[model samples]
Target: MYAAEEQAKGKPASVPRFSASRRNFLLKTGGISFASALVLAASGCTDNDAPNGGSLTPPNTTAIDLGSGDTGILNYAYALEQLEAAFYTQVIATPYSGISDAEKALLTDIRDHEVAHREFFKTALGSKAIVALKVNFSSINFSDRTSVLGTAKAFEDLGVSAYNGAGHLISSPDYLTLAGKIVSVEARHAAYIRDLITPGSFSSNVDSNGLDISAAPTDVLKTAQTFLTSKLDGSHLPS
Candidate 1:
C-alpha cells in the first residue's frame, strides 16, 4: 500500500510510507521541543558547560588533539559522538517539511542517545576531553528526506565501525567494557536507520566474513572530514 501510495503521488517507490496516522502523530507531538529542552534533560552535560556551551559555533582552534593511549581512544569516541549529536540537533531543529512523526521520533531518540554518549565521554575523560567539534553540514540538504536519512545512515554505520575498530586499541579493561556497551547501541542505531531507508538492509555493512567493517583512527577521521570544519589532529592516536 505504501509503495502504491507513493507511486500514485509520483514519489519514489524506495521511500518509506507516511500514512494518515503518522501525520496525526506529528500534529499531536508537534508541541514538544525535543531538540532543546528534552535533549538537555536527557544528556549528562546538563550541569557541565564547556567553553563553547556545547554550541556548534565555537571559536576556531589550531588543532584538536586526541591525545595518546586509552585517552586518545576515548577522545576519538567523544569526537564521533559530538558529530552525531550535532547532526541530529540540526535534523530536529530544521526537520524536512514532509518529515513524518515517526521519523521525528526516531531521529529525536537518536539525538538524545548521541547527546548522552557525548556527555558520558566528556565526564569520563574529565580534563582529557577534547573541545567540542565544529561541524560543516553545508554539504547536507536538510530539507530533503533522502539526504537526511542517507546521512544518518552513514553516520550510524561509521560510528559502529569506529567502535569496533577502536576496541582492540583500548588498553584499559574498564574503558574497553564501556566501549563494548556503547558500540552495541551504535550498531542498533545503524540497523534501525538502515531498515528505515530500506527494509531488511540492516546487514548492509556486513562483510563476507559476516563481520562489520572496521577502520583505523586515521581512516575514520578521513571519512568524517566532509562534515567537520575544524582541523582534527589525530596524529597522536593509536594506529
Candidate 2:
C-alpha cells in the first residue's frame, strides 16, 4: 500500500526492504523492544513540568527553540534521531556501489533501528514533538561506501555523546533511565561503525578514564546544524 501510494504520486517508492528472515526478526523482537520503550515513555516517564506536553515553539524568530528542561532535551534527541533515520533510509534505498551482502545486511539493520528510535520519540513527545526536520545530505556521496560509512560513523558518535551530555539535565529518574537505555544502544552502533571503518578501533573514542567523551548541548547542536536545513535554537535548552 505504501509503495503504491508513492507510485500513484509519481514518486519513486523509497521503502527499504530486507530478507524475509530479517523482516520477521524485526517484526518480532524489534517491535517488542521499542514498544516497551514507547509505553514507558508515554506513561510514567514524562516530566512534571510538561504535564500537557512540551512545546517546540520558538520565540518570534525563524529558529526553532528546543524549549527548556527535560522537554528540550528530548526534543534535542528527537532531532538527532530524525537525522540518523533519514541518512540510513537513503543509504538503504540506494545502496552504495559494490556494497556486499554482509554490509547491506548490517546497514539495513541499522536503518530499521534508527527508524524505530525516530518513531519512538515522535510518539512519546506527543503534540510536543517538533516538526519533521528537513535534512541537507548534499555532502554525502551515497554511491561510495567510504563516504556512506564515514557519515554513519559521525552520526552514531554524535548521537551517543549528545545523550551522555544531556542525561544530567533530566530530573526525572524514569526519563533519565530511558535516556540511558537509548544511549547504550547508540554506543553499540558507534562501536560497530567504528570497527567497520578501522578494524579493532571500536574503543578509539574512550578517554583515559575509560569513558566516552560527552559534548554539551550547545556543542552538539552546533555540529548537528550543518546537516540540518532547519535552524535549531539551543540557547533556551537547560543549562
Candidate 3:
C-alpha cells in the first residue's frame, strides 16, 4: 500500500443518469449548488456552522492520506457515494431539455437511492467516514442526455466492480452485510444504465465470460481520479 500510495494522482471521467419530480426546485445549467445542498442535507452536515475539525472532518489530507484498511475502504465508498449522489441530484433538479416525464420520475428514484446510500455510510461509519469530496465534472456536459447517461454507465459499472473487488478485505460482518446491500443496488443501477446507453451493453458487460470484473482499490481510485480534487490515502485501508 505504501509503495502504491507514493505513486499516486490523476483524474476520473464518466457519466451518470438524471431524475427527480420537483416543479418548485431550480438549478443553473451545469451548476452543482443544488446537488451540494441535497448532499449536505442527506449527510446530516447541516449549515448551522460546524467547528473546523469536528469528528466529521475528513482525515484525508493529500489523496495519499486516504489510507488502507477498513477505514480506507469505507472512505472509498464514501467518496463514490458523494460522487453518485451529487450526479443524480443535479440531473433531477435540472433535467435535460428533451427528457421525458417518465424518465424524470425514474431518475428521481435513482437520485433518492444514492442519497440514501450516501447517508447510510455516513451514519454507519460515524467519525471514521471521510468528508464530502470536492468533485470536478467540467468534463461532463450535464445539458446533454447522451453524455450524462454515458457517464452514469461508467460510474455505476465502476461502483459495482469496486464493491465486488473489496468484499474480502472488510472485517466486520455487519459492515459486510451493509456493503452487500449497497452493492446490489449499485449493480441494478449499472444494469439499467448499461441497457439505456446501448440496448445490449449490459448483456455482455455484466457477465463477461463470468469474469466478475471486480477491481482492486488501487485500480478503482485510479479510475476515479479524473473527478477528484483531493488525494486519497489508502494506508490504514485493507489490502
Candidate 4:
C-alpha cells in the first residue's frame, strides 16, 4: 500500500531489484536467451542482505525470488508486472496482421496497467527489490493471433491464482489489500481474454465454486515457466 504522498513517485519499473543470492537464483532458473545474456553482462556486484532500496541492476534471469515477508509480496507483484509488461510490449510491437482496432486499443490499456503496476512495486520496495527482469518471449509466435491471445489468457489467469495463493502469506494488511485489488483486475483480464478466445470461454474456465481459483507458487511458476526463457526455483517463494 503506497502512502498518500508516495503515490506521486511516478510509475514503478516492471520488476524488483535483487540481492546476490537472488540474482544467482534467477540466472539458474532463467533459460538461456540472448536477452538473458545481455542482462547478465550488465549486472555486477550489488549490495546483498540490505533488504531495502530497489535494486539498481536488471535481474540476471526472468524469475523473481521475492524472498520473505511483506517485501516479498511486493516483489511478487513486481515480477507479475514485469511479465505482463513484457507480453504487452511484444503484443503492441508486433501486432497480428488481422487484429481489430478495438482489440489493439484494449491491449494498449492492459500494457499501461502493467507498467503502472510494475512501477508501483519499485517505489514501494525502494532498494530492497530485485531489478527489472530481462524477458525472452521468442517461443511465442506473435504473428499468430490465437497463439498470442491464448498465452495472454494463461498468464492473466495464472496471475490471479498466484495472488490468491500468496496473499495469505503477507503479514501486512496494506500490502494484502493491494494484492487483493490487483488480483481482481487480473481476473477481469483473464475473463476478457478468455471470452476473446471463444465467445463463452471466460466463465467456463473459471471454477463454478468461485470467481477466482488459488494456486500454489510451484504450480503457478511452473505454468509461467513455459513462457519464460529462464528456469525458476519455486522452493523459495511462499506456496
Best by TM-score: 2
Instruction: Provide the overall lDDT of each model, using Cα atoms, as 2-decimal numbers.
Output: 0.70, 0.76, 0.63, 0.62
RMSD of 3: 13.6
Clashes of each: 0, 0, 33, 22
* Error in Å for residue 179 of model 2: 0.8
Candidate 1 regions with alpha-carbon error over 4 angstroms: 1-61
Candidate 3 lDDT (Cα, 0 to 1): 0.63
Q: After superposition, how far is residue 191 of candidate 3 from its true place, in Å?
A: 1.1
Runs with alpha carbons beyond 4 Å of true place in candidate 3? 1-61, 207-211
lDDT (Cα, tens digit) per residue for candidate 1, span 111-143: 767876776666556566788888999989999
Candidate 3 per-residue lDDT over residues 1-239, each given as its tens digit: 43244225221111122334243221121123333332322332222321121112235545545434555666778888888898888888778778888667667767776876676556545565677888778888888999889888888888889899889877655556667767776776776677766777664564546654688776777767777775665544556
Weakest lDDT window of 10 consecutive positions for candidate 1: 47-56
Worst 10 residues of 3 by lDDT: 9-18
Q: Find the candidate with the highest lDDT and give its number.
A: 2
- Kindly provide the TM-score of model 3 when superposed on the true structure, using C-alpha atoms: 0.71
Candidate number that wins on TM-score, 1 or 4: 1
- The order by descending lDDT is 2, 1, 3, 4
How high is each candidate's TM-score?
0.74, 0.81, 0.71, 0.71
